[model samples]
Target chain A: DVKVTQSSRYLVKRTGEKVFLECVQDMDHENMFWYRQDPGLGLRLIYFSYDVKMKEKGDIPEGYSVSREKKERFSLILESASTNQTSMYLCASGQFKEQYFGPGTRLTVT
Target chain B: AQSVAQPEDQVNVAEGNPLTVKCTYSVSGNPYLFWYVQYPNRGLQFLLKYITGDNLVKGSYGFEAEFNKSQTSFHLKKPSALVSDSALYFCAVSPASGGSYIPTFGRGTSLIVHP
Candidate 1:
């Protein structure tokens, strides 16, 4: 079984604070993704990494950036958190077609 | 480009009754369709997929889905519903013929089963 684990289940941050959401996958999958899920917007991809230090911007990557310094870890970074960034963040790692996801981190920015 | 649509925001049914959660998709080429279920506070779980061969595919927990290429629809169905089946259902689509590996997911339909 592929296990994807997120660093935090819930996080509360203030405006202008830097936030980091970490994800680790045990399956050693090469592709990793970060998404923000909203009520009716479904899951919007924020960023994806194909290999360590390589990244691509997704549909919604304006307020976010990513780091993949290690094969098993992917991190999402918020340069300066804002209230609009409050949502459930999901991390996934897998090959094509099937993506194994972590439990997700519910972030609340004040 | 690829996209998935689950029109209904919510669907309600009684236990032991038949249930259907609708999904439709559009892609440049033939698609790879997928259905996933997400319980409250949990990550999405893969239910089934339409890779090829069978129009009707069965998945975990007695759930099944039918693919209609002409209609561009892949609707999930179950003969009998259970309270535990209630969850957020998502449909996804990815192009099959070398377009893109990443998939597009629907907004999700919340199913509520009455006991």
Candidate 2:
């Protein structure tokens, strides 16, 4: 079975603080993604990495950046967190047909 | 751009009854469709996917989805619903040919199974 693990299951940050969410996959998949899920917006892509040091902006990439220094790990960085940035963040890794997701990190900014 | 649409926001059904959650997709090339389920406060779980060959693909938890090329739809179905089956269902789509492999997800449908 494929396992995708996130660094944190829940987090709370104050406004204007920097935040990082990490994800690691054991399947050695080539593609990794970061998404923020909202009630009505579904899972909107924030950023994705196809290979090490290669990143692409998804539909909503503002105020967020990604790092893929290694194949097994992907990290999402928030430049400065705000209340609006609070959301359920999910990380996924896969090749083509199927993608496996992590448990997700619920971030709350106050 | 490729996208997926789940028409219903909520579907209510009695336990042991049949249930359907509608999903339609738009893509420039052939579509790779998928269904995912999310329990409360949990990440999404892959229910099934339609890649090629067969139009009807069966998945985990006694769920299945039919891929209709003409209608551009991939609706999810279950023979009999259970109280535990209630959750948020998402439909996703990606282009079979040229494009990013990342799948675009629908807004999601909440399934309610009443006893």
Candidate 3:
């Protein structure tokens, strides 16, 4: 079975703090994606990595960066967290058409 | 670019009754459409996909979707609704031939099953 695990299920950070959300997949899929899901907005892509060290900005990548140093792990970094950055972040990994998702991390910035 | 749309924000149905959640897409090439369901505070789970061959594809949890090329729609359906089926349903689309394999998701439709 394909397993995608996120580092944290819930996180709280103060404003102007740095935040990191980690995701790891056991399937070794070639693609990893980071998305923030909001009410009514659905899942908006923040960043995606096709291969190690290769990253592309999705629809909304502002204030966020991604790292893919290895095939199994993908990390999302917030330069400086703000209250507006609070969201439920999801990570997915897949190849071709099918993607598997992690449980998701709900980040709250105060 | 590929895009998907779920026309209705929410759909309400009674338990044991038939339910349908509408989804439409716009893509340049043949579309690889999918249906995913998200329970409260959980990630989305793949339900079904319409890649090729059969226009009607069955998936997990007794969910099925029909791919209508002419109408550019892939609506999700269930024979009998259940209270457990209440969740947020999202439709996604990806171009089969060219472009990236990353699928674009719709805003999603909230399904409510009343007893």
TM-score of each: 0.98, 0.98, 0.99
TM-score of 2: 0.98
Model 1 over residues A1-110: C-alpha lDDT tens digits?
Answer: 89999999999999999999999999989999999999999999999999999999999999899999999999999999999999999999988678888999999999
Name the runs in model 3 displaced over 4 angstroms.
none
Worst 10 residues of 2 chain B by lDDT: B94-103
Model 3 alpha-carbon miss at residue A49, Å: 0.5
List, in order, the clash count of every candidate structure.
0, 0, 0
Write the residue-wise lDDT of candidate 2 on A5-95 in tens digits. 9999999999999999999999989899999999988999999999999999999999999999999999999999999999999999998
Cα lDDT tens digits, model 1, B17-76, are 999999999999888999989999888888999988999999999999999999999999
TM-score of chain B of each: 0.98, 0.98, 0.98
Lowest-lDDT window of 10 residues in candidate 1 chain A? A92-101
What local distance difference test score does each model get? 0.94, 0.95, 0.95
Candidate 1 chain A TM is: 0.98
Q: For residues B2-82, could you state the per-residue lDDT of candidate 2 as single tens digits? A: 888898999999999999999999998898899999999999999999989999999999999999999999999999999
